[model samples]
Target: MQLLLIASEVFPFSRTGGLADVMAALPESLVRLGVDVTVLSPWWQSLHGQPTEVWRGSVPHGGRLQPGAVRVGEVRAAGVRYLFLGTPDFERPGLYAEDDVERFLRWGNLVLPTLQSMGLTFDLVHGHDWAAGTVVAHARAAGLRSVYTIHNLQYQGRWNFAEGAAWSGLPAAMLPDAEFYGDLNLMKAGLVFSDHVTTVSPTYAREITTREYGEGLEGVLQARDAAGALTGILNGLDLDRWNPAADPDVLPMTARSGKPANVAALRAEFLLDDAPILSAVSRLVSQKGLDLLVEALPDVTRDWNVVVLGSGDPLLEAALKGWAQHPRVRYVSGMNEALAHRLYAGSDAFCMPSRFEPCGLSQMISMRYGTLPVVRETGGLVDSVPSDVGFRFSGGGAGDLSAALHAARLAWDDRPGWQARVARGMALDFSWEASARRYVDVYRQVLGA
Candidate 1:
């Protein structure tokens, strides 16, 4: 199959979150299955890797033609071709502006014509997130089969209908479907026009078709679910990238022996005394339920040493900042990949008490490192963290999370029980190969193969 994968950002090029990781691992996995894949992404100034310009053309936007070029990335990771859409609009300082409507709309308008100019043909085009949402609409309109995956439903790209219609170059007839409550919704366009829609997790896919988690698109998701066009494929971890066995950030592989050295190293690094380590590596956002962790910290700190690494939202940052003074707690603001790897490798237990997690990768990463995950039973957390590998609690309250941690502490006190759970976590496979096969099945189904 010739598959065109469109995403706003791709790992090793430009990345802000998990979407980039997905674009990297998924395409490679598909290619391993002997499927031909070409990835389309914007060429940001912050993009890594050298790329050679392959095609130059004009794309329609606001009733005029704008110059754009397609560049092929030199990285050439794992047999998947990388194509970047380079235009002056993307040459700005940041990958995205505060209001992304106009910028992404123009880029969306460029897709069909850009493909035509390059003479690139694909059996199917798959798009991810709101940034690539418009590709589904454009591809479907041009008679190409398409699939759109929602990484996060909260970030629907809504804009003024008049301006979006003008810049997007979409016809009046399609506007009704694209518009949500008088605003042009790029996510709605993708959801409506694509042949099939997928969310990050199976539970999340079900959640979005309801009033609580739908983000006001419940009816549309409900119709898609009824028509057998919606799927919830759990996101997978890149085993190669996350393997504790070969990870350079920590000591070489072992499910047991290497863990003690890493734990010792982590203790020395953080000035922590010998205690069962509990860590949370996240973006420090309300969505992640960091506040709940903060609330539960007073209860968990005496029994466990805590490590936190992430940056976002000032209020959440401030909440974690005070914990730095605590002797057993170390709060490092901002993301550090190496530190994160070490944290996962070293920590006895990892916490992700998210109110709503759309297939969290951290829990999977933690499990891959043979660490127990203390997660609320929601979204992918519900799927990945089984009773054997981790601790789970229900409800959004701090009391529930505190109880889960206290339960984890008891298990930690039991050496035999703790080791058994760690071994189980290591044994579980949350691999991309499994997820890719599912995607291939989706592709074949959409193609009527």
Candidate 2:
């Protein structure tokens, strides 16, 4: 099957979040399953010197034909073709900002036409997140099959009709699905126009159809669910990229046998004295529930040495930084890829107490490294990290997280039990093969092929 995968961000070219990783990994997986996959994404200032094929096209916009040049950078990676589309406005310094929504909405007009100009054709178009939805919407109008996946319902890409809707060149009469509270919600357009809808995790798929997590599109999603047009496919981890056997920064450890050496290394680097270490590699955002971690620090740190690596939300950053004053609590204020691997292998436990996680990669990585995950029971965390594999707590309060941490400490003290839990976590498979097959099935079902 031939597939055109559209995304707002593709790793190694542009990225701000998990969407980029999914875009890169999923296409690779699909190609492995014998699907002809082509990924399309926006070009940004970060890609100024990258290799690409350039072409000029004239798109009709604002009651006139607007002449513009579109750049298509081509790269063949992991058996998939990646196309980065660029225009003058897209190259203007940033991938996303408040004003970028309208620009992206308008960029939808550039996608299919540019592909046609390049003689590219596909059986179906699959779009990701909010920014790329218009491609699916456009594909639907043209009588082509399309699938839309919501990576996170948190960002819906709502915009004013006058400022951005006019750029789509789609008449207001043809855009009833895009309407949300008298405004244009691009995510709604993607959901309503696509042949089928999907989210990152099954739990998240169900959560988003309810008022609490729906973000004001519950009615539409509820209808999709009733019509059997919605699916929740769990994301797969790239084992080769995250495996300790291959990662030079990390020593290969199985079931915590070799974890002590790495733990000593971490203690030496962070000036931490001997106590079981609990590490977290996450953005310091309220959504991540790092604030709950801070609240539990006083009680949890009495016995555990804590180290956190990430940066976001200035207020949360400041609060975490304040905890750095304590001898056992170390907060690294930025993202370091190598350090993340070390933390995964070295820490006694990894904490991911998210308010609502769609599908978290960290817990999987931690489990793969024999680092037991202490995750709250919500969304993918519940699906991925079962109580037997890792420590799980219900409720979204600091006390709940503290209770889970306390269990982790008890488990740590019980070496045999902790090792057994680590072994179980390591035994779990998270490769893209199964998930890729599921996606292929979705493609076939959508196309009736």
Report the number of the highest-lDDT candidate: 1
lDDT of 1 at 422: 83
Q: How good is model 1 by TM-score? A: 0.97
Which stretches of candidate 2 lie above 4 Å from their native place? 60-68
- Per-residue lDDT tens digits of candidate 2, residues 1-449? 88999988888778777888788688888887889999988877676348566566664442233565666778777798888887777766766777777878877877887788778888999999888777777898778899999998888888886665677756566687787777778888899999999988999999989998888889999999999999999998988788876679987676646777888888888999889999999978777999999999999998799999999999889988899999999999888889989999889899999998889889999999988999988788877997887999888899999998998898789888888888898989999889888888888899998
The TM-score values for the models, in the order shown, are: 0.97, 0.96
Model 2 vs. true fold: TM: 0.96
lDDT of each: 0.86, 0.85
